[model samples]
Structures are given as C-alpha cells and as structure tokens.
Target: MEGETKLFTREELKCRCKRDDAVLIIHNEVYDVTKFLADHPGGEEVLLEKAGQDASEPFEDVSHSSDARALMKKYKIGELVECDRVQTKNSFSPNWNNDQSQEQGKCVIG
Candidate 1:
C-alpha cells in the first residue's frame, strides 16, 4: 500500500480544527496544515478560520500563484471519503470573469 491514499470522514476532520491540529478541506482533498500555520503568507488566522470545513469556495476565491498551489501538495494527508465529497470549483483556474452582470451594482470608474 505504498501509494494508497487514506480517506477521512467529515467528523474526523472536524475534530482537528484546533490551532495545534488544523486540518483543511479544499477541492475534496484533506490537508494537515498545522505545521504550516506560521509559514502561511495570508496569516494563520485565514487558515484557522476555515479549519475542519470545506474551504473550496474561499480557497478558490483568491488568485493563488502556481507555486502556492504546488506547495499545498506537501501538506496533503488524504481525501474526503466518497460520501463527503462534493464537486469543487477549479482552484487552479478560477473563473473570475464568468459573470460580469453580478457586478451591476458596483460603481465602475472605468
């Protein structure tokens, strides 16, 4: 079972939400970011806020660079079990311009 990936349930994820044991779910993948808290550029607060929950939306909202995305692989511990998995938006290529009409109320200086 050298390459076999472990699976985790939502409950299991919820139990590790503390600052000393933070776990994040992004794109259906589970990551133990406890050790990374101090190194996070956005500050540990950002990660702690979404600990033990599906952070796909927030994670995809920011335009993360290629290097940042690649670095996440280091913390990946497992994937959400099939029953808890959901379709996550593409984090790598977020559709920032998908709906221009949604900004109708915003004042456009340009």
Candidate 2:
C-alpha cells in the first residue's frame, strides 16, 4: 500500500468538487458529475456546486460501498481537478427506473 494513491475524505471531495466536475474512481469504476450537478434530479439544492468548504450532509444520503471507499485511495487526484466523463449515477440520476420498484434494497448495479 506504500505506493497506492491516498484517499480523499468525503469532506475533501465535497469541498473541491462542487463547482467543477469530478471523477470519483470507486472500485476502478468512475463517476463524473460536473454539468450534472445543476440539473441533478436528486434535488440540485442538496449538492454543493463549488468549494463546499464547510458543506456537509450533501453526499451522506447517497449510498456507496466501502469496497469502493477502499478503492478511492487510488484516485485522490489533486486540487479539484477534472477528467473525462465516467459512468456515474449523476448521468443516470434521472433514470432511476421504476421497472422494479418492488425490489428495493437490491443491488442496482451489476
């Protein structure tokens, strides 16, 4: 683990990635949420849009995996950076399909 990238706290990410787009590399999977913040169907008011210096609770309600959290160490990119878009719930936030609403608590992603 000596050479592994460091992990950025949720607070750290929230602080830097509000106004700009961010690539949240989780478990080798990535999520890009730049332009999507303003249009977020998850209540745009909930997400911070710029250096959320003291912002908290924005991402708390959202569910994420600890395995993904461990993987986060590989992607602690510096200083509110940007990257090519990656698959993220943001891009598909509006697509929370009700095709199987009865199957709540089930894994939504494969």
Candidate 3:
C-alpha cells in the first residue's frame, strides 16, 4: 500500500482498450492486464470481452483458483472513484414504482 495508485473513473478505464493498452475493472478495482494477456490461463478473448466494464460477476463465475487470485495483485492499477462511475443511456432513465399495475396489488403473467 505504500505505493498505491489513485482513483480511476470508468470512462478513463474505457479509453485503454487497444491490444497494447488493455485494462479491466473487477470488483470495482482497475487492473492493467495488458502485459498479462499472453499469460492468462483463460486466454485473451475472455478478458477482451470484459475490457472497460465491470467483470466481477463473470470473473467470479469462472471460479478462479487461489493461485489465479494471487496473480491478480501483480496487475493492480487503481481503484474506481465512487462518484465518477460511467453513465449509460439507461442509467438516467426513470423507473415506474407505484404505477397502475401495482394499484390493485395484482400481478399479470404472460
């Protein structure tokens, strides 16, 4: 922790997408895995799909071994700033809460 890096926004991470500048977000933390692509046990395709986005779910889904978990630290880049998350078109859209469908407390199945 003595030489820990600073926070990085999602947008900032997305900018590093080229083969030579790959970066991934896992569990809200950034990891520059560019150099590790060739060494990745799962190969580069999986990492490419998760590039620039949160890969926590998929990463956990793979059930990486303890050795793989320990290897991740070598690529640690930085943490995501809580207030600087990237926003998609749907992120700002309004959600229906107490609308007519819920007035009668009934559910419709189609």
Best by TM-score: 1
How well does candidate 3 match the true structure in TM-score terms? 0.71
Q: Model 1: clashing residue pairs? A: none
For residues 5-89, what per-residue lDDT tens digits would candidate 3 score against the true structure?
7787766677787678899887667898999988898999899878777777788889999999899998988877765433322
Please give, for residues 1-110, the per-residue lDDT of candidate 1 as tens digits. 25989988777677788899999998779999999999999999999999988777788788788998999999999987776665433433355555434321222222
State the lDDT at 82 in candidate 2.
24
Q: Model 2 off-target regions past 4 Å?
A: 1-14, 21-30, 49-110
Summing lDDT over every window of 10 consecutive residues in candidate 1, give the lowest-scoring window: 101-110
Each model's total of backbone clashes? 0, 3, 0
* lDDT head-to-head 1 vs 2, winner: 1
Write the candidate numbers in order of decreasing lDDT.
Answer: 1, 3, 2
Per-candidate local distance difference test: 0.79, 0.39, 0.72
Query: Each model's TM-score?
Result: 0.77, 0.26, 0.71
True-vs-predicted CA distance for residue 21, candidate 2, Å = 4.2
RMSD of each: 10.9, 14.2, 11.9
